[model samples]
Target chain A: GAGVSQSPRYKVAKRGQDVALRCDPISGHVSLFWYQQALGQGPEFLTYFQNEAQLDKSGLPSDRFFAERPEGSVSTLKIQRTQQEDSAVYLCASSRGATGPEQYFGPGTRLTVT
Target chain B: SQQGEEDPQALSIQEGENATMNCSYKTSINNLQWYRQNSGRGLVHLILIRSNEREKHSGRLRVTLDTSKKSSSLLITASRAADTASYFCATDGRRGSNYQLIWGAGTKLIIKP
Candidate 1:
């Protein structure tokens, strides 16, 4: 892909419902990251992966948030029992490596929980 | 918790004027990077400065990092209306292989044409 791509640009879910967001990172990238951005705020780190390994999940707000990069190419962020506070934009980024390389970001999926 | 904090929550300027934003961090970092985001869009990387480097330049952007003060400044020369966007400063602590990037709230810049 020319750039990172996210699916279902927008999602509306009722409280307690589950929603899944997908990200297709740039081809051949080795590092993937997920972030959550609240209105009028900067993106907050959620999780990070080096290829298929989930190296860091410390930033996940709760156990309800789960992310997986099965093939190290595409990833998915699933939130269970969504709450109103979950309404925000979920962003995905990928870098060439796990080092201090530049990261390319996807447009993100805007999730609205009501 | 956020490691970086950007000053001047918002700034309004006319086109062609230069805009400056500052960021302060709490701990030591391996590198500091700047990013820009338009409304309802993802962030775009602007520049990255390593801890060993005092300053760096890219096109109309100039970034200065002071590890002693744990601060960094970004100067955009000759700003245009298109430059109106939110700017963020992120820090890479280089703890391990994960490379976590702590972000600041950001400074919103509005350039009037």
Candidate 2:
């Protein structure tokens, strides 16, 4: 079976620039999540989506961060005005059910803001 | 912030030895899960143990959950060089009608062949 996939495995953006990371979850996965992991640290939750609805965005750091899963399958995490502090690995994961304990992950997009 | 910590931040052992990692959390959880991540790669789900289950086994991986103490442990028996990686424990907590996983800092394991 196909696993979750993310685009732009590595991204380099200048400060003040905007970046968008894409995630393609496994076929028929209903729950999607986004996380940010700094170097040598665990992943920090960012947002979650149940189908096309954004269920939780409390973990989003600031207004500069936005996410959408318009079709309930593919998702995109956008960071506006990138900052050096925003440099980290952005991870995406999906589960079969809304509250499934097991989740499949994507390779993630490593964002570097210079 | 992380919910708890994984003890022995790092461990190094020879191949074919058993490796054990411990994790502790602060809140009640529905389940605890283990994940493995290799260098520059996504995490792979290793095992999941519900709060009600005391222990579980999958292949060479063994996971134990202690709800009373809010802790868990992952033990890998007869490990191989491929087992060298970071192992993380995630506990699921309530998030409105749903649930979200709270992750630990993870334990780095190094295996010498």
Candidate 3:
């Protein structure tokens, strides 16, 4: 793809339900990032991946939040027991090499927990 | 906590007018980047200025950095209606730590045609 892409552009789940969001990064991009953006706020980093290695998972908000990039080029963010506060947009970004480079972002998946 | 603070939370200008946004950060940085977002979805990279460089330009966009003050400014000259969007500033750290790019609240720009 010419740009990074994400699936399930919008999702509405009841509280306590589990949801999964997917991301397809640009081909051969070594760095992938996940961010959580609340209404009227900037993106907050969630986690990072270097190839298949999970180098950083520090920004994840809670134990209920989990992300994986087993194949390196694709990633998934899963949220368990979604809460009302989890209603926000989940964004995915990719960079060619790592750090310092500009990150290409996906359109993001908007999750609304009811 | 966010490292940068974008001043004038919102801005409005005419199509032919210029728009200027400012950003201030707390810590030392190796580089500062500006990005634009429409409807709060994806972000498009606009410009980047290194710590040593004071200014850079791309088309009608001009960026200036003052390392001593830990601040940067973005100027969009001869703006168009399509230029209306939120602008954010991000900084790198620790060997280009991918998720470590500290971001600001952003400035919402409205270009009236």
Deviation from native of the Cα of residue B111 in model 3, angstroms: 0.5
Error of 1 at B57 (Å): 0.7
C-alpha DockQ of every model: 0.64, 0.66, 0.60
TM-score of chain A of each: 0.97, 0.99, 0.96
lDDT of 3 by residue, B1-113 (tens): 68889987999989999999999998888889999999745899999898899999999999999999999999999999999999999987545443468789999999998
lDDT value for candidate 1?
Answer: 0.91
Better of 2 and 3 by TM-score: 2
Tens digits of lDDT, candidate 1, A61-99: 999999999988899999999999999999999999866
In candidate 2, what are the lDDT values of residues B1-113, reduced to their tens digit? Answer: 78858988999999999999999999887788899999766899999898789999999999998889989999999999999999999887554233577789999999999
Sort the candidates on DockQ, descending order.
2, 1, 3
List candidate 3 stretches off by more than 4 Å. B94-99
TM-score ranking, high to low: 2, 1, 3
- Model 3 chain B weakest lDDT span, ten residues long: B92-101
| Deviation (Å) of A110 in candidate 3 | 0.7
True-vs-predicted CA distance for residue B34, candidate 1, Å: 0.2
Give the per-residue lDDT of model 2 (tens digit) for A16-92. Answer: 99999999999999999999998888898899999999989999999999999999999999999999999999999
The best-first sequence of candidates by lDDT reads 2, 1, 3
lDDT of 1 at B53: 100
TM-score, one value per model: 0.97, 0.97, 0.96
